[model samples]
Target: MSSYKKLIYFTLLLILLVYSVQILNIARFPSQIDIIKGDSRNLNIFFPFSLEIMEESSDIVKINSTNAERLSVGLKNSYNLESTNNGIAKLKLKFLGIFSIRDIQVNVVNQAYVIPGGETIGVKLNTKGVLVVATSEIQSIDGKIYNPARNAGIKVGDSITMINGIKIKDADHVIQLLNNIKNNKVKIEIERNNASFTTEVLPVKSKQDNSYRLGIWVRDKTAGIGTLTFYEPNTKKFGALGHAITDVDTGTLMKAENGEIMRAKVSSIEQGKKGSPGELRGMFFETDDVLGKIENNTTFGIYGTIYDENKLFKQKQLLPVGFQSEVKLGKAYILANIEGDKVTEYEVEILKLEKQNVPQSKSMVIKITDERLKEKTGGIVQGMSGSPIIQNGKIVGAVTHVFVNDPTKGYGIYIEWMLKEAGIYVNNNSEFAEGK
Candidate 1:
C-alpha cells in the first residue's frame, strides 16, 4: 500500500469516532421537570431541569433511591429539595429522576372550621333570640279543645309570646323547656302580625320516641329567602338570602375580592333523583354585577341586597314571608335571567321539602324539566347561586351547587332560611297574606 492509501483509512476511522460521540450525547440528556414530590418523607423539590444538547461525551447520571445519591459522571442540571413535613423523604433530580416518601407527620389531619353543623348535637345559634318565621300562622300546641293554637286556627305565621306562662326566648331555650316540661296542660301566648292571643294545650306523646312532644317545630336559626328576614316593615327595608355563601369543597366563604356574580343564562335544567339531584347551567359574563349586596353569609346562602323593584316575577306575584309554610313539594318554577335584560321563567319540581330539623341547606330537592333551560346550562352551574326558587307561585329556595360528574343534579337553599337570617319575618311570622 502507498502512503496516500494509509492516510485515507485513518481519516475514515476518525469520522466514525465522531459519529459515535454524537449518538452518545443524545442519549445522556434529561427531560425538563418543574416539580416533584421526593421519596424522602419530609422533602419536596422543584426542578428546572431541561435537556440542553446531546453529544457523545455529554453527561452520565443515575438516581439511586437506596443510597439517596445522584450518581453523576458528567450530567449537568441544578436541583434543590425541601421538606414540608417530618419523616417524609423527597429526591429531586436535575439529570436523574425524582422520588417521594411520606412520614407519620405527613398524614396528620387538618382541623378546619365547617359551617353550622358539628358533632356536638343541638341546634346552632345564628342571631341572639331572634327567630325569623317562615309561616304566617302561629305554631300551635294541641290542647284538644277549640284552642287558638290548633293547627288550622294557629295560622302559619304566628309568633309565640310565652310558653307555659314563661316568656319564650330563643328556639333553643324553647326546646330545652319543651323537653323537660312535665305539665300536661300549659299556657301559650302568641302574636300575629300585631295582635296577641293566649291559649292552653295538653302535650301529647311523640309517636317516634314516646316522649312528650310539641306538635310544632320551632327554629332558633334559619337560612332561607323571604320578603324580609328583618323588616323595618316600617322602614320598608328588607333582607334576603340567609346562609353564608361558601365554596363547596373548600368550605371557605369565597372572598368577595376574588369572586364576582355575573348574569348567567340557563342553558338547561334536569330533575333531581332520590340521592342524585340536578342543577341549572348558564353562560356567564364577567361584566354582570350581582343583583344584591352581600350582607350576611352562612352555610345556607349569601344574604345580600336586592335591587329589583318590579317585585312580582313574570308569572307569579310576590308572596310575603308568612306564606312559605304551605309551600309543598310539587310543581314549581324559578326566576332566572336566561335572556338579555329580561328575567325569564323556568319550570322545576320540589321533590322533597326538608323540615327545619334537617340540614337542607340544599333545601327543596328539585329538577329542571324545561327543554330551553336544559340546552343553556347543561344543568346547574356557577353564577346562578342566588336565583330565587319558586314553588306553588311562592318563593321557596335558591340554586347552590352542581354535581361535578352529573350536570343534571344540583343543590338548593331554602328561601325561608335566607329571609330568616335577614330579620324580615320576625319570630313566628311564617304566613304570607296575599295582599299587603
Candidate 2:
C-alpha cells in the first residue's frame, strides 16, 4: 500500500476506535450519573453507587456541578455534589470503625467535575463512599445442632465477618477458598450488630474430588427478582418474577427454587447520604408459596405459570410492561402478591434515578417510607425480590436486591430491562427510559 494510503487507513481506524469508545462511554453515562446522584429514586431496592471506601475520616473527593463553583477543600480527597447546590460539596463524615470489604469495593470512583467558586472549569477527583453488598449464605438454623461450622464458633445468623483474617471479598472468593482448602482447618470471623467474633473449622474430604468440604453451605451474591409472575386461582399455585432464584455459592439456580417469596414490609429508611447508603426492613412469610414446577427462572424474571391467581391480585389483569419512567420520586408504592396473598402496597420514595449503564442492579435508588411496611419486612429483606415497584399509578420495576448493612436501602431492576431479557417488547404506549 502507498504511504499516503496507509496513513489514511490508519487515521480512519483511529477515528473509528474513538467513535466506538465514545459510544461505549455514552452507554455507561446513565449509570455514572446514578452513582453520583445516589438515592433520589424512591425504591430502597436499587444501589446506584459503584465504588465505596472504608476510611476513618469523612473527608471525601468532592463532586461539583458543571454550572457551579468549588470550595476550599483538599484536592485528592473524596467529595459529593449537592443536588441542590450548584457547585462541588463535601459531606460531613460520620461512622467510624471497620467497614465491610464489599462496601469498599463498589464502583463509585470516577472523574467528577469540581467547580471551585463559580468557575465553570472544574477539577476531577475520585470520590469515596459506602457501597452495598448482598448475600444469601447467612446461616440461622432454628435448633442449635452441633456441627463443624458451629464447633468453629460460627453461630447461626452471625454474618461471616472475614475468612482467615482476610475479608470475604465476594461469593466467588468464599467458594474458591473453601474449595481449595478442602479438609484443611481454617479460621473464620463473623459480625453481628457491630460486634465481631472468630471461629475455626476443618473441611471434610469429599469422595467426589478427594477435596475438602465444609458440610456447611455459604453464599455471597445474588441478582434476580420476580413478582408472582403468574397465579392460578384454583389449586392455589403461584409463581414469581418468572425466573429461578440462584445460590451464588453453588453457582446453581435453586430448582423449584423452593424458597418462598415473603411479604417484606418496610419500616423507616435512612436518607442516602454522601458515603453511607440507606436500607429498609420488615417481617415476611406471614404467608408462603408452595413449591411447584420450575419452568424458567432466568435473569429476566422468575417464571412458573402459577396455579392460583385469585389470592394474588385484587383482580388479575393480563400483565403489561411496567414503565419505569412513570415512576415519580416520592410517595411510590409496591405490589407484592406472592404466596397466595392480595397484592399489598407499601410506601417508598425514589431517591435517585440514573437511566444509564447500571450494573446487575439498575442505576436508581429508593428508600422505604412506610412504617407499616417496615414492621412487615425488616426493610427490603429477602424473599421480597420481584415485588412490583409502582409509582404514579403504573408498574415500573421489580425489587431485585437488598442492602445487607442497611436493608432499607435495596436495589431494583427496571421492568423494561427485565422484559427485554424475557423477550417481551416495550410497546409504544409504554415509557422507555431515555438514553438507556
Candidate 3:
C-alpha cells in the first residue's frame, strides 16, 4: 500500500477509537445525581477526551470544573461540583468541551439530620392476615391422606385473609373457622402479591385429633429482636432491620397490619461460624413498654412513628444522611448493641459500594475489623441487621445481610432509601421534584 493510503487508514482507525471512548464515557457517567445542600462533591471523569461541566444554574449547583486541564496517563480529570441550593440544577456534559453529549440533572436536597439508633428493639409484627407457610398431608378420619389446602389451590406464601366472608384474625381464628368449614364448602379469600382472590375448600376431620383441619400451617404473628437504624427527631419516625423481616420457614416478606417496637436487652450470644449464622438472644415485654407502633414493613427496613421519645438512644454527635455517591470505600463504624442494652461503636471497613440509582438492600460490602466485636459474637450476627453504618460523621448505611461462608463480612444498605421509606424529610421541595 502507498504511504498516503496508509495515512488515511490510520486516521480512520483513530476516529473510530475516539468515537468508541466518547460513547463509553457517556454510558458510564450517571444521568442523574443527588447531593446535599452545602456539600461539595468531586466528580472525576476517568476517560481522557470527554466532558465539560457547563453549569446552567450557579445558584443551585456551582461548578468549578476544568475542561482544558491536561492529564498525562492513568490520571482522571478533576471536576468539583458544589451544591448551593435546595433545588434542582442541570449540568451539561459536552464532548471536547463543545459537542453536547447529555445533561446531568442534579437534585440538590437538604441534609437529612437524624439520630443514630443502635438500641436493640423488640419487634412484634402482626401480619396482615394468616400467612400460609406450608401445606401438609393429613390422615383423615376416613383412613386416607388428604391435603385440603393443596386441593383447594392454596399454596405457600399466601395470606389467608377471610373465610366465609368473615375477616380472619389469627391462627386461632382460622381454627374456629375450620369448625364451620367441616363437611361444607367454604369460601376462602386469599391475598397473593397484593392481589385478592378466593377459593373453596371442605375441611377434613383428622383421624388422631378428631378436629376439622385444612392441612396447612399458618402464622399470624412473629416476634424477634433487631437493632434500630435511625430516628428522625423532627418526624418522630424510626427505621430498623435494614431489610424486610421475612418469615423463617417460607421466606415471605411479611406484610404488617400492625406491629410495635419495644425495648429489648440482649441476654446471650450464639457465636456465628461458617455455614452457621449466630444470633443475639434478648428479652422484651410484649404487653408493656411499647416504644412505637410499626406503620410499614418494607425491603429497606421496618418504619414507624415513635410514641416514646425517651426510648431512643441519644447520640453525642449529629448524623446527616450520606448519599450513595458520597459513601467512600474505607473505614467506617457501626453502632451496635451486642450486650445488655448498651450501644457500642464497632469498627468496620467498607470493601465495596454499589452505585445504585434506586432502592436496594445490599448497597455496600463491609467487614468487621474490630477485634472486640469479633471476640464477642464472631462478626455480624442475626440481631445486628439494622446497625447504623457511620462514616465521615454521616449515617452512610446499615448492615443488612451476613456472609454465611465468611462470618466477618456482610452487606449494608444505603441510609437514603431507609429515610425515604420512613417518610422522613428528604426532598425539600415537592413542587420542584414533581416539576421534573
How much lDDT does candidate 1 score? 0.42
TM values, all candidates: 0.36, 0.38, 0.81
lDDT of 3 by residue, 291-319 (tens): 99999999899999999687554434557
Which portions of model 2 miss their true places by more than 4 Å?
1-23, 26-244, 248-292, 308-314, 317-320, 337-342, 356-360, 426-436
User: Higher-TM-score candidate among 2 and 3?
Assistant: 3
Candidate 3 ranges beyond 4 A from true positions: 1-32, 41-59, 62-81, 90-105, 139-144, 207-210, 314-317, 425-436
Scored by TM-score, the top model is 3
TM-score of 1: 0.36
* Candidates by TM-score, descending order: 3, 2, 1
User: At residue 41, what lDDT does model 3 achieve?
Assistant: 79
Candidate 1 per-residue C-alpha lDDT over 102-216 given as tens digits, one digit per residue, 9 for 90 to 100 = 1111111111111110000001123322232332222223323222235434444455657777766667676566667854667677665446787776555444554454455
Error of 3 at 90 (Å): 5.7
CA lDDT of each candidate? 0.42, 0.43, 0.85
Please give the lDDT score for candidate 3.
0.85
